[model samples]
Target: MKKYLGPILFFAVFEAVAVTLWLTMDHLFYLFNFTYIGGSVALGLVLYIRKWKYARLMVQLAVGLYMLIYLGILSRENMQIEGFWYYLFLGVFEAATIHYVVAKIAGPLLFGRGWCGYACWTAMILDLLPYKTPCGPRRKLGYIRYITFGISLLFVGGLFLLHVPDLEKVMFWSFFIGNALYYGVGIALACAFKDNRAFCKYICPITVFLKPASYFSLSRVKNDTEKCVSCGKCKTVCPMDVDMTDNARRRKNGTECILCLKCVEACPKHSLHI
Candidate 1:
């Protein structure tokens, strides 16, 4: 019963969002959308508790493909950062705008960067790269994310300032091209840095929103000092290079944690738990 609590709570939270949106937006799509995503997440959590090795990967694919193919391609809704800016500038509360609010912004307060670990379409592909754990010390190149963030803002703001015609079609194409660029750059960076999450750590603009709220994430991995034997296995396995031995919210690279649970799995002493 205790192990089942995590998935149940996650499913309930998503269901609450689904029901609220369905009633407020008068659209069944909201209900279906959140229900499917929430269910996938919950299923992953259940599988994880059962000690299934690929549970997280399964959830990533299930959610990522649905967003990338169905929503971004088939439905022609750009769920990327640029799309968020486009929708936000228009003062609309739909599509990517709502998505950013839930998954990238407010949601991080509760779940940290769980979206990065379990659902990001970009990471869905990047995680497939050969580099799993970081090979070298973290670089100072994280400043690149700010540049990318600025580029996204300027690109979309430019379109609005110019009052471009056929905006929807343009946004759809941008979605396709933006994703292509992400995969290409993500792969290239992974090869160069020998780190699977190099793009996430250094290039992804969404982290700008995810990091701040995630600093105070209610659900995060904590270190049990009593159980720890000073083993460094957790640090070596951490994809984000977080200092997991430190339980403080302000621990080194704390906000970078994606809640991947790699540290927990690596700790032979069972010192880490989420």
Candidate 2:
């Protein structure tokens, strides 16, 4: 029962969001969207608890492909950061706006960067690259994320400032091209850095929102010292370079944790848990 609590809580949270949005916005899509995502995540959690190796990747694809293909392409809703800005400026409280509020922005306060680990379409493809672990020390280039974030804001702002005609079409095209650019750069950086998460660590504009809210995340990996032998396997396997051994909020790369559970899997002493 205790072990199942994590999945139950996550499903409940997402369901609450689903019901609220469905009732308030008068859209059944919200109910369907969040329910599917929540169920996928809950299933993944159950698989992880059962020691399934590809549990995280399974969730990543189930959610990521659904968003990228069904919502973004078929339904023509831009779920990207640029789309969030586009919808926000139009004072439209649907689609990307609601998505950002629930997933990337305020949602991080509860789940940390779990979205990055289990549901980013960009990262879903990037994670398939050969470099599962970083080859060298983390670089000082994380400042690049801020630059990218600013660029996204300015790009959308420029379109509105210029009063571009046929704005919806342009936004849809931007969503298409922007995802292409992300995949191109993300793959190149991953191969260059020998790190699967290089783009996530240094270039993802969403991190600007995810990091601050995630700093106070209620769900986090913790190390139990009483059960511990100081084997450094956890650190070696952590994709985000988090020091999960330290339970403090200010631990090294603490906000960067995506809750991927590689650290937990690698802990021979079984001292790590959420």
lDDT top scorer: 1
Which portions of model 2 miss their true places by more than 4 Å? none
Residues 1-274 of candidate 2 have per-residue lDDT tens digits of: 8999999999999999999989998999989999999999999999999989999999999999999999999999999999999999999998899889888899999999999999999999999999999999999999999999999999999999999999889989998999999999999999999999999999999999999999999889999999878888999999999999998999999999999988888898899998
Instruction: Single out the weakest 10-residue window by summed lDDT for candidate 2.
Output: 225-234
Query: Which digits, one per residue and each the tens of the lDDT, describe model 1 over residues 225-257?
Result: 999998798999888999989999999999999
Clashes of 2: 0
Best by TM-score, which number?
Answer: 1
Candidate 2 accuracy as TM-score: 0.98
lDDT of 2 at 81: 95
